[model samples]
Structures are given as structure tokens and as C-alpha cells.
Target: MNATDRTPADLLGSALARDPAHPLVTFYDDATGERVELSVATFANWVAKTANLLQDDLGAEPGDRLALLLPAHWQTAVWLLACSATGVVADVGGDAARADLVVAGPDALDAARPCGGERVALALRPLGGRFPQPPEGFLDYAVEVPGQGDRFAPYAPVDPDAAALAVPAGSAGGPEELSGARVVERARADAAARGLAPGARVLSTLGYGDWAGLSAGLYAPLAAGASVVLCRNSAALAPEELARRVASEQVTHTAA
Candidate 1:
């Protein structure tokens, strides 16, 4: 475990410095036959750009809530880190009416409109393609992110004790909120529980609607300094096809 890493952003920074060329995340969509891999450096770049978009353009400050209306896609993972870097609390599947900002995919646009704050939409297309027809009353993320700076420096240091992530109270007792430090701690715990080590590759087929899925699909591998094969729509894949992916991606561990 990394004693110095107190937050998700810290873990990402450590990973970026340890090995920038190593693959950090490999994403797939079984139905679309799409696969994309991102190195640590590349993923960091995306995080930086998205952070800038949140901070500079949207004027989002620390403690502000962002209702994230997306699924378990690679871009959603990027948004998670970006929120941590900026000290913005990401409310996964949260109530848009209570948010200061909103980011949604094409399918979630209808659910995002209640937020009066600045709204952003992601196409979630292959290779990060822009929406062919822009949605009204929203900024297109793919079109805006390229113009952002490659490096990010938050105006203020993030507070580890402050809330970072809030999951909707689905079938649970109440909403679950975690501080930055707790997020890192849980990720590390999950990573160790799954027997991940540095450079280990993990395959996960979990959605991002709750803490369990987030831990397995993204944060755990990242905290372990390992990599992930993040699969979207895994239910569509045949059993043989799933086996093929495990062999092809060289997955050493699995969390599902």
C-alpha cells in the first residue's frame, strides 16, 4: 500500500510517475466490438484536460456537487479522477436537481435537465468521437476537451477529509459518501482483497452505479498500481467470447 497516497488523485499521480507507458485501462464494448487501451500518461492527460474544463470553463469550485449521469465507460472513469483532482464531489447517479453541474451521456440527457447548472454531454462514441448532432442546452465534451491544456494544476489543494464521492441511496439505508482519504483507503483494501500487485492486469464487468462497482472496475486496480480491462455491456458477450478476452488481454485477476 502507498502510505503517501491519500486520495485517488495522489494514486494516479504516483502511477503516472512510476510508469507512464504502462497500460492503465483497456476498455471494451462487447456488442459494438470496440476496444481501446490507454497508457497511464494518456489517461492522466485526459484527466488533466477534463479537470481544466471543470475548473476554468465551468467555474466549479471545491465542495460543489456534480451529478454524473453516465455508465461504466472509460470517459466516466476519466471524470472520476478529474473530480478528485479538483476537489469536486462526484454524485454518481445522483439527483440532478441538487447538483451544481451535470455531465451526461446521450442516453442520460433526459435525466440531466433538472440541474440548472451548466450541463455537459458525452457522446461515448468509439475513439471519443463528437456527437453528430449536438444536444441543445449542453456543451459537447469531446469537442471542448481537445482545446484544454494538457497539464493541470488545481488552484487550491484538495482536502482529503472533504467529501469526494456520493453514491445514490438505491436499496441501501442511506446515501453513501466518502472522503478523499477514505476513497483511497477503500481502493487499496479492495485491490489487496482481489490480490492485485503492481503491473497486474485485472478484468472487471461491473457497472458504476454503486461503490462496489466503482471499487472493482476502476479505483481498486488504480490504487494497486495495476491495470484494468474494463468491460461495458458484458451481458451481451458469449461465454466463449469472454474467455477469449481474458486470454487476449492477459488478465491476471478478476473482480466481478
Candidate 2:
């Protein structure tokens, strides 16, 4: 892969071709006692299905905004890449009302109701199960995604210069947009600044709300050809427990 290739989809493709069976994303939910590990191939599979759902099922075209009302989990990582692959702009934590599609978790149901476009809900259960009783206005992601094609092809090729992310300002500013190339550029720089060596396994307990967090938690690792061990409900863990996880999971770098 060329060093200048900056699209998230291109980063993933490089990773898959370099090491298909290597761990890509390892997720842990301390509150739920859930742990899932996805290799590069497995991660790519999930991204493909979700991308197909976005492109084909939801009619998401290039530049379409999809509000990702989700937390830091394995599937959320999948959705980010899926959006890149399908040329959709992932608006993480953005308002659903302004989006073309909304993919929400249980906590965001009420907030996502006003979204007039397509809505998909993730139960976030162990093994990615569907809700016992489906939410009234949202399609269950687990139920719908499995039926999508395993392979994904965007309606049109993604332009590296096109907007790929919409990040709301944390302080006193308007929302910031990042092009596909910029996303990759930022990730690589952030990874190097954080001293993430090549193929490092990084553990992070951060939300994907801003550029820094998103870069550290997902894109940076991909840019470095590293893997991520994403931990949610991190408040439930003691300092010693976190250290134990770092050792057990073979985490070489950490972004707290």
C-alpha cells in the first residue's frame, strides 16, 4: 500500500492484505461482561455487510450524512469504516434530525425518533443479538445486516477529497468537516505523536466524539497497522484491573 493512501477503506484494505487473521479490534464491555475480538478478515466482513446495508438498503449516496448515535464498541468501529467504504459522511454524536440516516443504540432511541430518514438500532447485546421486542420505528441492525450482501461496492468510487466526517465542536465553534484524505493524515500524525509503533496493540477508553479521540481509538491504529482494544464501561475497572487487561491483551500502547 502507498503511504499516501488516506481513505479509511484503503487503510482497511491494506491491513487485510497484509495480515488477514491478525486481530483488528478487540472490544470489552465491563458493565456487561462482554468481550469480542475481530481479526482483520472478520472486521472486514462486518464492514462489508454494514456498508452494503448503507449503500443498497438505505440508499446512502456519496456525501450523505449518517448520524452514528453509538458508543465505543466493536460494531461502532465497523460502522465508521462502512461509512467510509460507502462514501457516506459519518456524523458521530451529531443530531439525527439533520442526517440522511440514523444508526442508534438503545440510549439514543428517543433522540433518534425525529430523524425522518432510515433508522437502525443496535441492541448491543452479547454476540450482537437483536432486541426481544423490536423498537417501533427502528430496524434492528442485527436482524437486517445479516441479510445484506457480504461483499460491498459503493454506488460510486469514493473521492479522497470528499468530506467523510462531521465532528461537532467541543468548545465555541461550528462543526468541523474532515475529508477522507485529512482523516487518514490526522490519524497517522496522531499515531506517531502518541508513539504507537508499527503493529502495536493500543488500548483506549475514550468516546469517539472529537478528532483526537476518533484518531486514537480507531483510525490511528489502522494507520499504524496496529490493532485496538476498545474498552467501554471503563469506570467499572480498577487501576490494577486495567493493568491486568493491558498485560493479558498484550497492549503495547495506551490512549486514555
Candidate 3:
């Protein structure tokens, strides 16, 4: 099907059905010093799991904002895909203070609590030690939300023109909302126009929170049913390290 004919659900579903074993995401874990890979099927499951958590547990009704402050991790991609399927407005925030739900590591979680807002802490054991004890009345993400189920049923189809995400307005002091489906459609068209194949591997050094990051790094590849190798610490690392990772990962396309 053409890009316009597919929703995020349809795209992901097709990818999973066509090549469930294909690697959808690959990331380098600094702590483990190993590259972690998640296949299309595994990614679909995590997206479903995240959808269940947002819709069933969080009571995040359709059109409700579900902000995230996650770093560039596999879970971040899962949450984005989940939001699309569940009809939740997934807002990617630049900082914890701006987000409705912050899926952060331990240090970011600690720093964000003082902002005094509702947030969800996505616990990654590899990110750090066990979850730190929250102060009085703070929500512990793992404790509050039940584990996601095995199967996920998507919500009703969304209007392509509807607002899908909210981004920070540059120097404007407020958030700017954008159409999710439109962005996906455009990106898909662009990728196809560039002759990108379904399973092509892409190297992206964009930060996870920004527009380019979300688009080129995550959505673009997924929309095209391709693989993405994301470098979260691109700015801090040397050029050689970046080159090594790209070559090692066998990246076919790059948005560097």
C-alpha cells in the first residue's frame, strides 16, 4: 500500500508480518558496552505493552496528552509507536519540566520531581541502579502501572489532519502542535522517493526529543519499515567513535 493508505498501526503491522525477525532498532548501551537489537516483532509487542499501559492503566483517553522525557532508547521508539496506535497525543519534550509524563533515567527522574507535575518513570535497570525511593506522594511508575498485556488492540482510526504531537515553540514560550499523520506521510514519501528499501539500515545521530530526531531518527525508518541505528551521545563522542559505530552496524543510510 502507498504511504497515504497506511496508518502507523498498518505500517508497523505490515512490517512485523512481512519480516518479524528483522531488526527494527539498534542502540549502543554505554553501561554494557554492547549493541542491543530489537526485532520488528519485539518492537510491536513493546508498542502494544506501552499502549495497554497508557490506555488501560493511566486512563489516558484518546486525545489526552502523554508527554515523554525519555532519552534516545529503544523504549522511546516503542512509546512513540504506542501513542500512534492508542490514539494518545505523545508529546516529546525538551526537558522534564515541560512534560506531562517523563520517562527518564534515575538522574533525570530525581531532577524532574521538583517540577511538581504528573509523570511516569520508565525504569531501565541498565540505565542505573534500582529505582530511587520517591519522596512523599510521588508516583512510582512500575508500582502504579500494571504490566502490559500480550495483545494490543488499536483504537479507532485517527483523522490524518488531527494533532498528534506538541513541540516546544522556539523562543515563543509555548508548545507548537503538529499533525502526526501528516508528518508520517511526508516522511514516508520522502524515503520512498529516495529509493529507500523496506529493510534498509539508517544511521541517525539526532537527539531523541527534537523534531528531526523524532522524524528522521525514529518515524522515518519505521514508516518505511526500515531499521535505524541511533547514536544518543553523538555530540559528546569523537568523530572516530561515530564512524566506528556506523561501519560496525553496517548502516546503509545516514542522516548525520
Candidate 4:
């Protein structure tokens, strides 16, 4: 990370400033045989639009807690940075009832129903398609996000020391919470451990259910000015297919 990047959003901005056209996050759904790649500018646009939707449409404010029940898709990565931009604590797999807002995947809708706050759902489609039927008490994120402003300006400044993330107790790894500064610190450390350098292409098959997964699959590569190749349901891929993917994506590092 650069000297000025104390938060994930700042790290993203630095990446954007360095190379807006460079590919940032490339996502694959092994089960669906789908792939989507977003350049730095494209990813920033998505993050900005999502942040606007959270702040302007959903009325999210600094310190608000958002329960994010999503997977390792590109949209989930977008939501992470969006929450950072808006100062909303990203509670991954958190308690829905206590959230100020909830963003759930298709499988997570039922679990998110208890949230009294504004709720949104992602179809996790190949091209970000909307659900044929919106779940009860939830907005369609794909439909709502595209209409939001292209740029985001937070209503209030985020406190780097304030709580920024919560990894709920889970089977993967968990029951941990962190401040914004700590999140950045951890990401930086993970990048170093992963031996990620600028321009590195790191492939990760980690989920988004815990801090370890988030650090390896999203924050670490992003913090290092490297790009990510995030694969969901990767275990379903045959060995040959996985090898082909690594070769085709020009993967320089691997995190499983």
C-alpha cells in the first residue's frame, strides 16, 4: 500500500490513480462456467454506484452496520469497497436482525428476512441480471444500482479507527471484528505473506465468510496494486480445468 492508503477505499483509489485501465478483479463461477473481468475504472464505477445506492437510496450513514450475506463474486467485492466508502461496517455473515442494511445472495434471502433495515438481494447472474421475482421485503440490487449516481461522495467522513468489519463466528474461521485501520493493516500483511507485488495476478478460491478469505481473495491483492482472479465453487472444477484456468488467466500466485 502507498503511504496515504489507510483504508481499503484509499487503496482502491490509489490503484485507480495509478492505472485506471488495468484489470483489477476478474471473477469466475466454476459451477456456472461464467467469467467477468473489471478494470480499475470499471470496478471503481461499480463501487461508486453501489456506494451511492447505499448512502442516497438506502439512507446509509457513517457507522451504520450492513450485514452482507454474499459469496466471492465480483459484486461482493464491489459491496466491500462500497461499504468502506460510505463508512458502513461490513458485517460478513452477520446477524440480520441487528443490521442497518442487508445485502444477501439468492441463498441468503431467507436468512436476511429478519433484518428490519433496508434490504437488497443479488441474483449473482452471469451479467448481473435481476431476479425474475424480487424476494419479499428486499430491493433488487442489479436494478437499483445502475440508476445511482456515477460518482460517490460520502455524507460524512469515515473514522479509520471506528469499527469497519465483523467476521461472524463460522465454520471457515471467525468470531472476529476489526477497525478500519486494522483491516488495512491486515490486508497489507496478507499481501506481504502472499508475496504479491504490483501487477501480480493472484488466483484465489477462498470464500467471503471470514477475514482470512476476505484478506486473501480481495483486500490483499487490491492493497498490493495486484489483480485478483476470484473463483467461486472452485472445488467443483476438474484438475485439468483448474490448470487451464490458471494458465489462461496468467496467474502468478495462488491462494486456496
Q: How far in Å is the alpha carbon of 80 misplaced in model 2?
A: 0.4
Q: Which stretches of candidate 2 lie over 4 Å from their true place?
A: none
TM-scores for the candidates: 0.98, 0.97, 0.82, 0.97
**Residue lDDT tens for model 1, 3-68:** 899889999999998899999999998768889999999999999999999999999999999999
Give the poorly placed runs of model 3, Cα more than 4 Å off.
1-6, 31-34, 94-102, 110-118, 127-146, 155-157, 192-195
RMSD of 4: 1.5
Instruction: Please write out the lDDT profile of model 3 over residues 1-256, one tens digit for every residue.
Output: 2444445666788788788899988876555564668888888887887788777776666676666667777777877777777766767764555545455554466655644445666565443233566434345555553467867875566665677766666686766776666767866876776456777888887777566677667777877778898766557667898788778888888886
Weakest 10 consecutive residues, lDDT, candidate 2?
1-10
Better of 2 and 4 by TM-score: 2
lDDT score at residue 158, model 3, on the 0-100 scale: 62
Sort every candidate by TM-score, greatest first.
1, 2, 4, 3
Q: Which scores better on lDDT, 3 or 4? A: 4
lDDT of 3 at 100: 50
Please give, for residues 1-256, the per-residue lDDT of candidate 2 as tens digits: 3496779999999998899999989999999899999999999999999999888888889999999999988999999999999889999898889988999999999989889999999999999999999999999999999988878887689998999998878788767999999989988888888888667999999888777778878999999899999999898799999999999999998888
Point out the higher-scoring one by lDDT: 1 or 2: 1
Cα error, residue 83 of model 1, in Å, equals 0.2
Alpha-carbon deviation at 118 in model 3, angstroms: 5.0
Clashes of 4: 0
Query: Candidate 4, residues 64-168: lDDT per residue as tens digits?
Result: 999999998899999999999989999999889989889999999999999999999999999899999988789999889888888888888888888888986
